[model samples]
Target: MLKVQEIRELIKLIDHSSIEEFTFEHDGSKIKMKKNTGTSVSVVKTVGQPVEIPSAEVVHKPVVQEVPVEKAATVNAEVIQEKVEIESVTDLHKITSPMVGTFYESPTPDTDAYVKVGSKVSKDSIVCIVEAMKLFNEIEAEVEGEIVEVLVKNGQLVEFGQPLFLVKPE
Candidate 1:
């Protein structure tokens, strides 16, 4: 039998460590603990007799998937075309979202937009705000330029690395 404090300490250690499973047996008592999608523990006790529980093994069947040759070729072709187009375009500075969040044009709904197309901006100018996890982060221009385009709408969900604006650097 394990003391309450010992069990609590064991649980804390297991939670902090990456060990996914633990099992112990002593005298006529057995304890098994497993951490999967959730954490669970099982205990079995017997007097003057030994109890044996079969160990559970997880088996993941191998998945066999087939991709059509034509589909793969088409995807590669599209990727090449996109790269060519991007390379052919004139050099313009892109302001990309630093994190996944909702884009806001103004600090407050009632305030004027921070930047609009043709608006001049200096490095360190606040061009927009990205609200992520309930925190509003001020996005700086980082480049001295004139706003060429706004790529995202107010309150629109922006993904990490997604372009938010294009600027023509001065």
Candidate 2:
């Protein structure tokens, strides 16, 4: 049986890292855990074989309840205000990464970034570059807008579908 502390620790470990899957095995029992890609935690368990344990027996217990870190951080007025400003500045048409790669805001290190917050852009504008497998793929805006938010920092590894920018329609 899994202890509550173990489960809670596992959850925290998964939440703080980019790993999406984990598994464990012990004493003829196996447990597998996975992080939901859609911003939530889901736990699933499977019993491999029938044991003499009672049907009403609880296999796991809830651990010490920790305050959600992100929620706690957002309770600050400054954080909330910043979030509101970002939302107000843009309707948030997201520009998403088309491939898994390192995101670059400019074509070259010495050049100015292709777009910055508040830069007006057209539908055909190339807003950034994603370098994958040594090839630089120009990321374009599909809608006309003003760039309002940059979701990823320069040189960061971005996964497919990760939002790179938020744009307010012009």
- Angstrom error of the Cα, residue 166, model 2: value is 0.5
Candidate 2 per-residue lDDT, tens place, 1-170, comes to 55657768988987776667887776755556666443333434444445333445545422223343354443454555676688775457999999999999998899999999999999999999999999999999999988888888888889999999999887
lDDT scores of the candidates, listed in order = 0.75, 0.77
Best by lDDT: 2
Task: Give the range where candidate 1 is weakest over 10 consecutive residues by summed lDDT.
Answer: 37-46
Winning model by TM-score: 2
Candidate 2 global CA lDDT score? 0.77
TM-score of 2: 0.57
Clashing pairs in 2: none
